[model samples]
Target: MNLSPAERRAGITVAIFCIAAAALAFGLTLPLLGLLMERDGWSRSAIGLSSAMAPLAILMVSQFMPRLVARFGAKRVILIAALSDAVLLILLKITDDYYLWLPIRFLMGIAISALFVTSESWINEVTENHNRGRVMAIYNIMLSAGFASGPLILVVVGIEGWAPFAAGAIVMMLASLPMIFAKVADPPFEGTASFSVWRYFLVAPTLAGAMLLFAIVENGSTSLLAVYGVRNGLPEGEAVTLISAVVFGGMVMALPVGWLADRMDRIRLLVMLAFMTTAMAILIPWTIADPVWRLVVLFAWGAAASSIYTVAMALQGERFKGADLVTANAAFGTIYGIGSLAGPLVIGGAMDYDDPHGFAWTIIIICAGFLVFTVIRQSMKRG
Candidate 1:
């Protein structure tokens, strides 16, 4: 398991590239699909359900990912998943029926979950605990940058034809090239057959909670932010740009937050982030009329909300190792899948009920709930 520093850096770089590529594709696809569906007269609820399919697929498949990687090896599994994603993106471009899209999106979700679970576990496996916070921060920074680039690309391409889909598929295929020639061996899986992924939630309830909260917020915002912007009177181009603004905030602030995670009590850091996120959500309804202020609020909001996952992942690496670590990561993906499924459903429903402002209110409520739960969890532990 001991790798020279250069070897470790190479491993980390390849893994990050793979995951970030997937993020880029997802970032492009989610909003692109949402805007397309909206243009075709799909209901908000129906669009939410369609958006939920990927995470639903993630929830169904994530628990098995560690075992799949163990059997197939990380590089092979990632290669296959990346290929599958490219093919699925092409299928989405060909199909015009919403019913068909349900299954296509679900299948794409499975591929994405595999990419996430395998790459994340691989990165943690190669990292030393002492520097995990900083490394994961850099990991997330790349991830957020990938996400930000997606919406920016969409703004340029205009989501009119096959161009956006073709662009996404090309990125998916290209991202896998690094893995095809990677020299490092896959990390050994030492988890026993009897180990349950759910047990990790009991072992690290706060980490589990943080991940779920993050999933709900991240998926909800990314999938629906464009829709929200349009409903509130922004042009389609401007609406899509809002997504980039949010992700750009996360990209800008991840390093500082990561640095803080390494030096502070992480639980306290999570609390502060939760508070910041809730406050930003409160300001959104007020700021929507002002473009510059809206971006500023969302940028700060994205920074705080996104850091929750960075700190939580760093904590998971600090707390577990080997087979257990892989299993814990699978559990993390599972919880994220669950949150992803619920986020769009709930937030979309709220928006359907109340229009544009519901989006802001739903985020506020979710962040507040997590903030309360985290505070109580900390208090009980101290007692």
Candidate 2:
């Protein structure tokens, strides 16, 4: 942990690049698989089940991540995971069988989860408290940018044949290059006897809750926003573009939010963000009718909501260290997986029951619920 400033920067940069590359593969594959399955005459149910495998893998694999990192080291595990991802992407392209894809997706999920858990812990280990916020903010920005770029690459390569899969494999392989050459030490992990990732939930309930809520809202909105747009009378193309607006908003606002996290009370900042998210959710119904205003509202809303994860991560680093921090991040990933699985089900059902407005209403309820929980938690702490 006694890294020089230059070494710390290099370490953080390498970790960020690894995750960003993973994110790029993630963003590409999630949509690519769905489109491919749909084209192959798979039922919606089958496609949904195939998609669920990855998050389910995250839930199953997260508990073991800390130990893996402890045993193999972060850098080695990351390189292995990235290589596994590339191989899996190629496998996905080689086989067109739905049964085969289920396991491939599941294994891909395991590799992807490793990349996130290890890289996040790596970032936290190298970062000092004073600059953790800014560094994590940059981390989040690159993550969003990388994820958003995946679809653009898909557009260029097209989803047919091996082109799309090949693009993803190439990126995954390329993502490992920086780590291979970087002169940085892996974060040290001394495995603990009583180390329980679940226990960290009690240790940092707010951080856990923030990650869960963010995952639900983010996944729910991303999966359904275009559907919501179409139901609300927008053209299909423009409806799809709404997601870009949200991503753009997140990318634009990450740094400023990071600056605030460094200067102010992060818990309070989280509360304010929840409030801003709630306000934006409430405004969506009104704004969806106007093209310009819809983008404006979503932009601000995306900025606030996405910053919740950035600030929560900064808080996690502020509060924990070493093996404990890795476990905490593993817990974060587990909670995120649960929320991702739940979000679409809950939000999609709401939309089914009430059309487009259900989309916004569901988000409003979740954000408001988080806001209330945060206030009560902070009050009890102060008392």
Writing each residue's lDDT as its tens digit, candidate 1 over 261-288 gives 8888878898999899889989988998
Top candidate, metric lDDT: 2
Q: Relative to the unseen true structure, what is the C-alpha lDDT of residue 380 in candidate 1, on a scale of 0 to 100?
A: 96
Best by TM-score: 2
How many residue pairs clash in all the candidates, one count each? 0, 0
For each candidate, C-alpha RMSD in Å?
Answer: 2.9, 1.3
Off by over 4 Å in 1: 32-46, 93-97, 151-164, 193-195, 225-242, 286-293, 352-356
- RMSD in angstroms, candidate 1? 2.9
